[model samples]
Target: MTEHLYQPILDHFKNARILCVGDIMLDRFVYGSVDRVSPEAPVPVFHIKRDLLALGGAGNVVRNLASLGANVFFSSVIGQDESGRMLESLIGAEKTVRSRFLVDEHRHTTTKTRFIAQGQQMMRADQEQTHALTSVQESDLFSALKNEVESVDVVILSDYGKGVLTPNLIQDIIKHASELKKPVIIDPKGRHYEIYNGCTLLTPNHKELAQATGYPTTSDEEVSKAASILLERVSVQHLLVTRGAQGMALFSRDEGPVFIPSKALDVFDVSGAGDTVISVFAAALACNANLEVAAHLSNIAAGIVVAKVGTAVVKVSEIMDAIHRDMGEDTKETHLLTWDQARDKVMLWHQKGLKVGFTNGCFDVLHPGHLKLLNEAKSQCDRLVVAVNTDRSVSALKGPARPIHSEQDRSVMLSAFDCVDIVVAFDQDTPFELIQHLRPDVLVKGSDYTVDTVVGAKEVMGWGGSVYLVDLKQGYSTTSIVAKISSGSRN
Candidate 1:
């Protein structure tokens, strides 16, 4: 998707007022390092280094909404215990969220403590009660909802199968939210989908969707069939099934199912990824985004959270950056361009009044010196294009054994850096032809080369362009690194 399509939708999130109701809990993480096994048992003993506390379940949804710059009205139940007080304090600390937590004196607050070592979860311990709320508690919750539901742009029911989301309470919430014409988004749980009747959208993972529909959700066809069954039973208008690695599938009444592939590059932890998906989806809907746009934004948000370490919240800036990166990926061809494509791109930049800087190198083995040169080059202009020598050109310049990494790999690595805006591969030994065609505003080279020694200096200077020579870092060279490794191997 283009930035024009989603940037405004993201901007509208700041004005959205979300009503989040359902289970809330404290998520405590103990981070440590495991050195060796304990003598008392076979388990490894961890040396605790630090610990952190974060909102989990529905609270995580509120955290996510708030992080994305939304105004959230969070309603949930908690015990009159220490854990409950902590949870309350945590919610109160968030400036964008207003919380109304009912205190249940008869129960203990839900808390999940996870032990983490070396960036991996070792064990988890939970303390809580699962009994359904009493009639009086339900009445109080409904009363709170009535007060908050009228002003909210959307309602999100984050049910973790805890007592806060009883069948009766779910029905009441959906009915009341519907009366106010607010779209209700449910992060659903359990097999009983009827309780969530009339919800605008239901977000269930692969396992939950399969179990709820009594069918195997192994393929797109199968998932659509299962979702169709749930749509018949429940009054939900749309079903979004989150298939872990495969991404999400959206089934609606008016249109056929639309699948959005996962954008996650690295899956570290997926603890509260669902909360992120629902939070972004609801917020986008609240901002008047179409169903497909909302689903796409949610997919991006989910990708961000899963790459994090734990039950995490994504900020608006992170989402914006991800969108821009995705946009860049969509136009990957521009980054790795031919001479004609590079000329076209340079002309486009020139039309926009952007200064284009040109640099050339084999970039066989990227080191700190190369990064410093590129960074300095970028500082001299608005856009920096690095001309990478092809494998054959590098072999001619630096011998056959040089360029341990291929030209494609080098080009990709340079393109990944934010400082280098574009990468173009040149077959010639030097970038003389490439530079002449682009006619960049500035020509950059290392300090080792004087202006007269630079290959394209005369051509660039003839067009009122300047030449900049960046200082290189000492004691860092690709040639030296390769030689050092080779010597070590011989030794």
Candidate 2:
């Protein structure tokens, strides 16, 4: 499937109105560089550089939904402290999200402070109270929910084991949402899933699932059995388990288990990945997406968030780009780009100081050889651009019998590989013009060609770039495979 297939779904996201209720907190990150050990103590001294503040817990869910272009009503409780004031101000700044906060004078606002050095967290400090809300606070929160429950399309319970999602509040929210025929999605916390009974769906990580069901959720079979038990115990209609690297699994009573693999290639920080999952899932439900589509979209959104450094939101444009990168066909709208789009992308990468690598091939029939070459090429640079020969060009060079697959098919196949970041077809026999226009930081080719014989190597070298010749995998060649197939030989 191509990204164009998701355009309609994305359009629906713009019209969604989501009600996000749960624990809200503030996340603070202090970035610096570790120099030497402190003279007063054994700790390393950090040279303070900068600091950042963002939403945390349920607040992050509101941020994610707003960033995805949803109209969000966020309700949570915070202390009447400085941190609480700061959190309220930040929420007010978002035009798409409306805040309905209940303040408690007895507690301090939850704050998580992290010390990061060189893009890594050195230490963390947290200040929070896990006790349930006061009677008055619970009543106020429920009143707010009752007022907004009828106006929203979906309700999300983002539980961080914080005090806002009390048992009574959860029950009331579920009942109200169900009465309004609005789906309720819960980002569950704690060992007991019974508190979230009657909710439409519950999203739990692998560890949480194990704790809730008391079953070893190490394998799919165990998870399936455990989820089945939890389903019977709780009133939820569906269970979504998010496995860190293994991806996510969705279980419902009516349908068999559906698993969507993780789309993340490079995971930086998984701080707020759960918030992203729930936010996207709720937004998709608000847009009337089916259970399977909602899960798939949420999986993609989670994949994009985990690749970032901290609690981050996935924008609609970013989601579209991810979909395009993952499933785009060879059409002009996809990875098979025009010269203008290619230039813009290259320029963007250059502005970011990213190393771009270029390699060209006919790729008539994809085999292990092509995979090896693309993988090696991508390893040498931050971005890899594959320039494919058009069908006419391939026929002119390798004869009419060559290129069993059309240019569109070949480009689509190459774009499907994770190692190939961008695919562009060239009309000429060689990608000389394409290489010159791209001016990639590195030029790559197979070991079959020397530095001198490689196409566009001199031009790239003149521009202070270098050429890389990856060693070919022995006994594997496209020509040999084609010939073998034609000769009906079993090798």
Candidate 3:
């Protein structure tokens, strides 16, 4: 999508009023490392590093909509417990959310706890009450729906199948909302698709679609077949199936399916990615964006979120940046590279008998010396990979006030140079992990570091790689530039 087309669609988000009704829960992520096997058992011993908390289930949908700059009206049921209070605080923290939560005294709040190590999920535990809502609770929810449905531009049913969206209430809400001429989108859960009779759209993953229709969805052809079967059998208007890495498929009664290839390059975690997809899709539809445009935006948003560490939110700026890069307009010959992406490129370079080069630094401010080093590094290899430190790592090394530019800005600056073939960012103090992963043929560094002092020199040498030290230009440094600026001297 072009910037001009996408920018206008995204701008519509600010003025959108969306009503989200369904389940809500707390998502907890526990991050740590496992090093040695336990003495008592054969399990790896996990050392806890930190814990992160976010909203999940339908609450996640609410968060995503608010993150995209929507004024959202959210209605859900939570247990009267500590987790419920935490969930309430999280909801209240959102600047643009108006929420109505009916406390269910008989059930505890739903919570999913995940353990992560080495950028991967180790295990997960879930706690919840999934029985259908009581009679009183269902009636109250329908009342809340009727009270808020007419005023919003769009209505979303985010069902986690936790009893809040009962069968009768689903029919009631859909029928009532349709009468008021408001569009409804559903992130459906469970296998019963018949109750969602008149929704504007239904979003289900491939597995969910197959489960609902009892048809195969392992391939594109199968997914289309399954989507067709479901749409034909049910009264739902349209279907959008998220096919994980294969991208997404959109199907309607009158038109053929439209398939969008996955935009994700490096997938770290897929938690809450569905919420992102539905949130963007509904917000776009509310603002008068067509189905295809909403699908593209949602796909891009999902790609951005999966590349992150945990259940994360996608901001407008990141989506804009991804769109810019997706258009092949980054630069003349530059594309940002992840560790896995750079390794794949190195493999191709090796296949063509080309030597791959690597260099590492914060590169906070580029000067004559930096250019000299890069030019010399490029002179000896066919492809050069510049691994820059992330903003956190830079703050740990330099002071917090240093690094005049952000990681993205720094990467763009380095990518603008002709000599830099690939630019990757690393959060560690040293680029040893990335270098060990890429295993470039030529490791380049400035003369300030000796053969013994370089981070990955030994590993490179072990793998038949050579380390070359470039001579630094005299009287030019990032420190000197910062000092000069601090002293009010430009010369």
Candidate 4:
């Protein structure tokens, strides 16, 4: 593919309009620090610290797509209740959201409150009504949906079995989307798999797939069979069966099921992971990504969401960063090339008195901390050259399953950054040779590392260059992101 081919795809995502229909829920997180045992009981007592409320379910899917720069329009049935008002307020405030909603007085809006203490989920309370919508409500929904379907690139049915997605409603949406030539993606729920027939794609977890198909997923073969059956039965173009740790399986009519491994390193809370997958897939498809590419990208997007807390959305930046990190971690070295080979172009760049900043790491999992460090490295110099350890090198330093994104992908992504002037793949135990050849004016590392301990600190200092420590962005690190996501808190 040409360098700019994917750029247009990403740009398309920035311009695509997506309509999200079905259930909308409010996700409320009650966060506290557990410091001591309770006086009344032996159990730990949590001291309340803060609380956060975010869009959940189908609403979260739109949030994720919106965060990734899509033109999002949300439509759903919400009760004429306080939580419904809250949902309206939140969705209305977003510039991209064009909502088509109905407020039913007979129902209460869905809201899930997760209480967390000491970075762990303590309990959860759910409030809402889940019943099939009346014919009148369904018709009203279809009327609004038909009007919006004509103008969008794709339609996402985010069903939490929360009443809005009746059989009639699903049928109408599928027919409308088909007529408009818009892809319809269903993030389905309950036992209503047949209701999602004629969808462009249906995304369900392994359990859901097994339940819907009456097949046990003991191995990849079984998973493939189930996915194929669902795809054929539902008359959908694609079937994505998400297997938690084993990753996802994609089954299409033209192509057999392809198993994609989970990209997530440390899974925290898997809340809304399916939403992340469907949103990414729909957005990628709307932007003209091939089904396989969309599936892979959405898999990576799920990896990002699972690595965070709460019902979180994955940004396009996060997806690109994941792709970059995967590339860096998968790089393989042919052999140790001589300085003549490795330093040919690099030597010229160094000789120009450019304040060449060098920062080297496995970057196995790129996070906000890494971004902050790279940005700081660039700020201290005219050009930033990021030296990433090769796959073998990372394995040696950080052990197995180290670098997530392969080295080539990482290099390509990092090179795309404005702050990153150049990217050099290194295979040695250290980037000593690259550093010695580049002789950077500033050697940058995270503040957690002292100047003396930085790998290339001494070399830079010996050549009259400065070894600087850039403090990590507070509360933003890969480890923290992982922990928070696992803990089911987004704060």
Candidate 5:
């Protein structure tokens, strides 16, 4: 399989504009060292060192979108207080975003203060009022939203339930978005799931899905049933249930449910992961990606964010690197790129001296064998692009139970490696179309098969390009690992 395929998608992120409307909060982190207990109370005394604050809630969604090169317009509520002033300063400094905040004296700007010691969060303090917005405040917020709703390609309802997303406000936004026929994506709160009627898409985590349906079962069938209920109940055109390690499942009106596995490998803190999801989703929609493709791109973005601690955002370079590494394409010839990011990168590389090399695989579980193959391919090219098979593709080729690691996990792990350059992931049985477009100088595959049998070998060779079969290290297969685990469990 060709690798390093996610470049095009990452390139697409540049210059996109997305409108975010909902509750915004500030995440304040107090970092310090704790060596002794407090004399006044039963608490560890923290010697404060540094303090940092980042956008949280809906603000985070906009921030993530901006990081990926999208021009973001944020519409939310804040108070005329210190924290609110800080929020404005923080967001104003973001050159990619324009803010139209409604100042409400009745409610303070929501802020969550987290105290961290030795890289561990000790406690969190939340300051906010979650009551419904007053009529006057709602009117002001509506007025601000009215000015931008018609101009943006997509609208995101990021409801943190912080008194900003009233039922009335949500209804009006939904109605307006419908008139413009723009996609309205929702990162729903459990309590207000029913109020997001006619949304283009609803992204709910596993816990929220369970809470919304009041179904406690963790079985796939049960979760699917619950997701269906919520989708129909809210009149949403599509529903995405985000399962932490399990990935995500997409349900559309005609396509039904398509499960996209989580890409996270080692999950540290999933704090603002949902915010990352909607931001990427809205950006993808603005770029004219299909619902399934948008969800897949969001799944890749989520994997990138969870690998970091605290509320984080993943950049387009990171996303591209992940896709390339996941696909096992040579990154040496290519710069880091995702499918959304590839068009521009490809054009630039054409002007430069670099030649793109492409390859792909499931890399279900990376072992020394896969590493040897990828390194060898990288050695033969200027840059390597890897295209990974999605969980769906793995099931079609390997088996339903194959790919022990989810797509997101596999992508993150591969992108972190130095040998890889860019990564892209595909759900098709083969990345033939992507390979054809890339028109790499070399098409690489494992030594197990002759070049004639390779999926994209003919396409590359026909273009006067060469097909190289890189040697795979012996005795390292996903099947072998599974068997070893099963044997140990039985013993």
Candidate 6:
């Protein structure tokens, strides 16, 4: 698909009110370097250095939803414990999410802590209770659902099988959501797919699909057969199966299956990727995206999350970037930049120890004089940024009929040159403010103008950068070419 395919869907994510009900847990990662083995055990001892904690499981789905700018009403069951309190605080910290936690005093809140060293996972420890919720706790949860199920645009059932989603409760939740005409998307867990029968969409990874359907789902035919069995058995509208390296398969009752390839650059951890998929998918559908479009965006989000080292969340920009790259489109093009883009590009170049050069012109027409000056400018620095005047500014500086070429055409032309690393447009009369904003390493101008007379020369000098005056190619100018064309003369 082209880059424009998902723009409308992405634009609809902002301010979407979603209800997420699931098993929320806290995930803590301990990072440190391991050099020697421990004296007590044969395995290497993990040295505790620092910790990074984030919402996981259903909480991760809420995090992804909130991170994508959705206002989420999230509910889950937690123990009356410190971890539960911390989970409460974490959920409260998110400005967009309103959380309701039902406490079971006898249970322990679920938490998973992983130890890492040099980008490799060492060990994982878990603290939790997985038994089904009691009558009172379930009743409390149902009460919360009663208050939220009718109001939200969409409902997400994030089932880690950690006891929040019981069979009867699941059926009731789906019934209520169906009555309200809200789509329910589930990131399912355990072997029971029957409880989520009425959900609008159900996401299960390759392994989960295989286990739930009792089919060997390694090959394409196996996956298709298994997905068909699950869809027919569960009576759901659609099923999206996420295959890690093999990509994703969408099985619809109307349309059999359409597969999307994996867009991940690398795979670090696959822990919370399923959460990201369901969250993005449900969010897309919540904003009125079709099944095909939602699956594509969700598959893209899943690919991004698996590349990270922990239970991670993906950003909207990251998803858009993957879509553009996956479709072989250049989103940034980098050849043309706005003033803000110029500043960011220069900052990145400086961080890499590359010298940046700056020069400005209308560049209405390509000429040997302009090429010579730009070449000299490039030779003085590692990256040469050519600032072209906008159409309005060009008209202000060189008269309305002079530029001959639009700013876009002129900028695209400059970007084609090997010497020009970056091309930016400026509407101002002079590039003095832009130069000061960028603070490039070198300022370039034609030899006709002295350093003392050149604009931004003093600022460049003040910033410890040098100025260069290139020897212009004589008898070659845009004005001369225009005059020759007007006179119908050939040299």
What Cα-based lDDT does every candidate model obtain?
0.87, 0.85, 0.87, 0.78, 0.79, 0.84
Tens digits of per-residue lDDT for model 5 on 1-491?
12223345556677576788888898997755679999899989977644668888888888888888888788888887999999999899888899998887777788899887654668999998777888887888888878688888888889887778888898888898899887888888865577888788888888898888887527678778888777667788888888888888888877768888888877766879998888888887887777778788889889988876667788877777677767765565432355645533443343243556777888887889888888888887777788889888998898878778887778788888787777778887778887765667678899898987998888776655688897778878877888889888542
Clashing pairs in 1: none
For candidate 1, the per-residue lDDT at 309 reads 59
Q: What TM-scores do the predictions have?
A: 0.67, 0.68, 0.70, 0.65, 0.67, 0.67
Poorest 10 consecutive residues by lDDT, candidate 1:
329-338
Clashes of each: 0, 0, 0, 19, 72, 0
lDDT of 1 by residue, 305-383 (tens): 8876567678776678788888775433334776755765665455344778999988888899999999999999998
TM-score of 2: 0.68
Of the two candidates 3 and 6, the one with more favorable TM-score, higher being better, is 3
| Number of the top-ranking candidate, with TM-score as the measure | 3
Which of the two, 2 or 5, has more lDDT?
Answer: 2
3 or 4, which is superior by TM-score? 3
- The whole-model C-alpha lDDT of candidate 5 against the native structure comes to 0.79
RMSD each, Å: 16.1, 12.5, 9.8, 16.7, 18.1, 10.1
Query: Model 1: number of clashes?
Result: 0
Off-target runs (Cα >4 Å) in candidate 1 are 36-43, 329-491
Put down candidate 2 lDDT per residue, 1-491, tens digits, no spaces: 44555677788888999998989999987755687999999999987644557899999999899888999999998988999999999999888998888888877899999887654668999988778987777888899769898999999989998788999889988998888898988999888888988989999998899999899887888888889999989888999999888889999988899978899988867878988998888888887778888888889988888876567778877677778778754323555876545654664555344778999989998888888899999999999999999888988988889889988888788888988888888998688999887788799999999999999998887766789999998888778888999999989
Give the TM-score ranking, best first.
3, 2, 6, 1, 5, 4
Give the number of colliding residue pairs in candidate 5.
Answer: 72
Q: Which regions of candidate 2 fall more than 4 Å away from where they truly are?
A: 1-5, 330-491
